[model samples]
Target: MTNLLRWTTPDLALTFVLDDGPVRLIAVREASQPRGGEPDPSQPLVEVAAVGHGHSSNRHAGTVLGRQLRYARHDETETTLRIVQEELTTGLRVTSVFEARAGVRAWTEASIIGPGSLELTNLSSLVIGLASIDAELYSAANSWMAENRWSKRVLRDVLADIVRDPHHHVANSRHAVTGTNSWSTGETLPVGVLVDRSTPYALGWQIEHNGPWHYEFGENRRGGYLLLSGPTDHEHQWSVEITAGKPFTTVPVSLVVGTDVDSVFAALTRQRRAIRTRRPIDDRMPVVFNDFMNTLRGDPTTEKLLPLIDAAAEVGADYFCVDAGWYAEGDWWNTVGAWEPSTTRFPNGLAEVINRIHQHRMVPGIWLEPEVIGVRSPIADELPDDAFLTRHGKRVAENGRYLLDLRSPAARKHLDTTVDRLVDEFGIGFFKFDNNTMTGPGTDKGGTSLGHGLLEHNRALLSWLDAIQERHPDLLIENCASGAMRMDYAMLSRLHLQSTSDQEHPLLYAPISAAAPAAVLPEQAGNWAYPITGTTREEFTFALVNGIPGRLYLSGHLNRMTPAELDLVRSALTAHRAVLDDLHTLVPAWPLGLPMWTDDWIALALNGVDVSYLTLWHRAPGPSTITLPIPRSKIAPHFPTDLGDWTYAWNDDALVINANTPEPAARVLRLE
Candidate 1:
């Protein structure tokens, strides 16, 4: 006999199929949509793999344990459900938990109920059959400077039909996106979207892990399934020994269903806000001026900062951050972790610059890489080898620095002391925490596997962030791993801001800024807008436009700007502040469908109740006109307020814009 179970949230519906054999998740769709028939029977609710006992006949499926587990029981609450299954031969117990929100947040846990030890190589956090086999897949590729480069691919094109007969064979191949090492988003975002080609139905998911993660979609005998997981034995050298009394849990991931791409992303935006730890500082969404991008460039001195401080304050910056080189006397690359002000660089002291920032009615902030210690630093010698990540009794060193294992009390204490001293001595209110090193697999310091060891350290890092935030409730921290590499909810949930990129060129940053909202919340994406002193008026405005839609991370040598140019900078800030007023309530839409790196024109719309804010950028050097498909509404100039060489008109539901400038330019428009 077959048993069917169904669960519904306000927006999503999940259907499960249970038989005397293994359990399967067959359908996931909008609550209003009808549940379909049994999908691929091999679509297990949770996939697992053990050391000696692996897959039976489907080892070619890239999985080892999905078919061996059988249904045990299930329990449900008003908003949460837990389904338990067991591998009777090995006494392995698995529980799949789901919490209903606007969408569904789910994860899985595994434990052994008997005496025999089980070493796990693979365990999935989520495994469910997608609604359709044919869909448009959306994923992103990330890097140091160029982040959020999204690409669209048809599911069939990527995962070919290798099945000879639909009733006889299933394809073992999979289309996968994997992020290895410590930077969760170093290679690609932990987020993805799928929109059915024939219908408006769509699905989106995000893996909330700060370290390595793996997500793959593959077709079985009938349909397709998505599997999300953390470090695996094949991918990240991660495995754990599970005995009778020990249990292992995979990282948490969230899934949401919507109608179209925009609706799916909007639901994700709402889900991100729901999980974020609310703070007053984050709510205010203050404008920050960091002297790193194109101005100070990690060589800040008292002389270089005083003028910048005044300029940032005069242009309405709420915070002034002295990024990098603050604690170094000279070449600080291999001499970090002391966390003391450089006496030679500042002459008087770093406090002099911090105090000057305070005198200008702005919060003082400093940069620090809390997770790394310079190899040549004395502190490296003071801290025991156990305080850092290690493998085979040797420290894991990369790029002239050692990655701190936050699991160590000594390491956490060192960071606590550094942060406390900076706050107490310099009156710092914000911190820009950067991680520049990528620790390969992880440490085998303990008897655990390298992957398991790294997972523990990753959890320890999050706990440390929580502890410090509790101690300093008002302190704000910005998450930057070489810039947007660690851009995941695992960190963004706690940190106040995320530096979108380290890209210096304004034209290059346009696409990064426009496409960032697809993966990150607008309020948290800290895009850099550095208008050079000698650039043309159009060029300066183009730079500032990159920052307006999101949190305006202001930079540049504003003190040396001409009077007219200075006013323009101030004007950009004023325009940004207006956007901040409704930013938290707005949902983003890309009329241009997620900018391409080489796209000549880009548009981002933040939709609100009564008004919609639009940012239009034309990067080509010539006269051009593009029509944006927006409903006809009363439109007006917003940013420069002068329209310069731009003209606009309305054609039915489309808004037409002509950029007559021979140089690159951009503008912010409002529609009501």
Candidate 2:
């Protein structure tokens, strides 16, 4: 047997077998890879002689379903793998899986979920040979899909800033350098910003020990597929549905960096290990509140005097939200760069209002689209030539504001400065990052664009988020790309919550588009109640309690409330706090409708107190049937979770119920 080159991370490991009969690989380590040592030439990476066999003629692994991956596989064999050893040198780290089946590609298998899935997959087909790989040559761009949007000049403009300055500050800020507008350049230079030999690299990127940065690692999805890929076309995708009074759910990123591969694998071995399956830091029901945006910018006022949020909160709301114009006296849509107090109305500054709300015994929350900048702002003018992210020598635009480029160290630095001032100094508790832009811009090549660099920018942004999280371990970040387009596993890993959309009118979300967070992400228990125009204020209060299976959220302007509405809102919050104490886990059950287009969304079954509750939604609404998978914990002896029908519903997903409307609904189907 030839000596295998074994490599590992905290959790997985692989070894390459050199043979004529097909390149073979084995999973030798399911535990953390060697922490700090040379690759032990003594052991096999895994305990398999399985050959890497695949359909000779297959397309690349599609970004999602219909698309193809870099590699393809035939049903080889199923062998379990466990981590045997892992080592990390100052410049290198290695991991080995001892018992893994032969040649089951790391990301190619279904074992990985959520952010881990994206991280593990290098391309559609190829899993790297070790824990880490560096690239002397690399491409930092979106994919082919992006080439059309941003030209080369815009990308060049961006690279100039990223290289010269790499941080964004609240004080040292620029409106043109945030969010999806993280534009970059093409007239390339050697990217040599390494300390010692250790540097950060996403999985699947090929690396050589020595060389200038000039390697190409193919097809890396920042998270998983694109949410809003080509203009929302004719997929006519249905909004996710749940049982009438039933609820539907989806995932968000939740991970705990374990101490070793064994510990990490051990976390995975748990039955609840899925994409969005980690434990929630909080387990309280969200309270109902309202924001008053009566077409403040000439959109349309939510009817009803004073609105329902205050009334909802006074009675029982846990969250109170203030929308866009609250801080803007005029058409401040152009005032995003300077996140300051609106001296005209909010005279005492936001703190006074927050203090009052806290005194009212309510959790104070504020909203911000942190990665966006308006055309007219001090940031654009003050920022030097080497600041904002640009593509083809121009700023990227969304809604009307230019998306900020987070890749710039200066951009990150500026972001930290502003955020620290606003959050740390201002004492704000929550953040809602809204993206009103389209998912534009991809990668770049030479002095032009090949459309794949967008992912690079996003990955860099994620890196920043990771750094930011390290700063304010408990700070809450909300993901809002129009609604669902940007809500992928990558950003989810760090965000504590999300605001479903900017269109706070509950009515707008009625037939629920997949864009609605409540339809997909259960963790983001958010609801947009028009100031007035809701079920009785009590019903509004009820809505708040009902939205989040484990927390509370509301969107209404507080200052616009009447005394009566205030009392009503306060009372509802009290009621929700009581039901929140009983949640331990969340499980997905059958959704309300049949799967639609590309979405197979369903319900989230949560363990509250002693019983489990299902919040459901389906892509297509109908009298259709569904068979859900029950966990081993809920199974009868040894039956697979997808067995038995217990009708309208079908095993652990066994409870049968009538079809509810095709919109998002919450059902209290109790489980033992």
Candidate 3:
């Protein structure tokens, strides 16, 4: 007879089969739902692939070593569970740990004693067999200025049905999504959702790593399986030689279950909040005016900034950030590293401009790319060879910049001295840390694999960020990589805000802003709202509305705008501050499904306790009226207060918006 072991949380339940063979994780479902039938025996709790030993049957599943391991012991607590398995021959032990937080998080740990050596290529963080094969996949493609472009596809469309023969052999091919290099979201997001077509069952997961990660949905003999991992030798050239005393641990991942896309994303939003470090700056959600998007565009001089600083203060901005070029004398792109303020750009001195921002009762912030030292930078030659990432005794150079190895004491000291001197010299409270280059496969430093070496550098970078935050408790930092390339939990969980995109056009920016909440928290999504001085009223409001829903990242030339335009900007900030009152408790919902890049009509709603807020965008001229499936409530214009040409009413519990404007337009409505 087969023995069964079960664990239950308030919202989720897991069932495992403890047999003579390897421990099999059979079912994972809602606690209130019933276990349908017998557990599937093909699903192993842990899957590992090494250099010497491969799989027993298929290249993807049925690992021989994984099947040979047997359960040894288990332990559980109010919010954590640990299961241990051992292979008697190699004396290798694997421990699978699960934690119950806002959602379920899991990881794997391995150690060996008598085994001479094992070079591991692949190690799974979590694997579970699905109940059915009929499911839809939801994933997003990310890029420089265009981020979070999500698309949905049927499972059969990607995972082919090849079980036509009498043998019923499972295919090894998988619908995989992988991310490489230093930018976690440079190619694809580290999160996805699998929703069952026939039932309401939906599963969502996010791999929490600052480096490479892999996840796949494929089939085995019994049914479909979802595998989540960090890095693999085949994909990322990452491998670790595990000796007798040296053990390895996989990166962590979080899993959540819900009914549909909205619910699943809501749970994910909560999980993001649960993992984030609590800081007073994040809670305040202050309005930051960055003079880069459409105004200075990396050319900030004392003469150009004094007037903008006055305009930002007049409009009630809490933080004024002088973005790129502030520290550049001339042609500073490839000569960046010693972050001293440019004497030529500021004429009177950068401190005079920084002090002017302080005189206006706003925190002064500046931009810095701390990870890379330009090829021409003197610091690049000043630091020792070991201070930078090197392969074959040569430094790794990409896009005219040399990557810094934070693990080196020299590199850390250089960064520490630069940051401390700037903070003390100017009373700087904010930093927009930008990364523009990518490390191809990492560095093979210290006789480690390139992937493992990059992994160490990633962790070391996080440690450095932690140290800086500890030393400067009141300082706030923004995580940026060109745009949203590094927009993952590993950075979001620690940083104060995220730059959603560097897209300049407001019309093109609406879709990104609407879909960003699915990946980033509402208060942390730093959406840029740069209202041009010469645009029409509708065009100007369209840009301002883009920033009102998330972190109102104000930009554009307020000094050049007419008095009427500046009033509109002030009104948008007022509406954003009101939304921040309930932003933490509110969850995001798409009245229209996940937006398309060129969708004529888009709707994003932030559902709250007593009152909710909704933003509607009519991007094209053809669609005069669009119906939105939202709760029926009294609606009032939150921003501008003047409805201009747009009008709305309730049909049952759905919203019907009539775009009376002839041109493109957008608006934020308060629903109560």
User: 2 or 3: which has the higher lDDT?
Assistant: 3
Candidate 2's TM-score reads 0.52
State the RMSD for candidate 2: 17.5
**lDDT on C-alpha atoms for all candidate structures:** 0.89, 0.36, 0.88
The lDDT, on a scale of 0 to 1, for candidate 2 is: 0.36
RMSD of each: 1.6, 17.5, 1.5
lDDT of 2 by residue, 421-458 (tens): 87666555556666554435432312323123344346
Better of 1 and 2 by TM-score: 1
Error of 2 at 654 (Å): 7.2
- lDDT-better candidate, 1 vs 3: 1
* TM-score against native, each model: 0.97, 0.52, 0.98
Give the per-residue lDDT of model 1 (tens digit) for 3-22: 88888888788889889767
Screening candidate 1 with a backbone cut-off below 3 angstroms (N, C-alpha, C), the clashing residue pairs are none
List the pairs of residues colliding in candidate 3: none
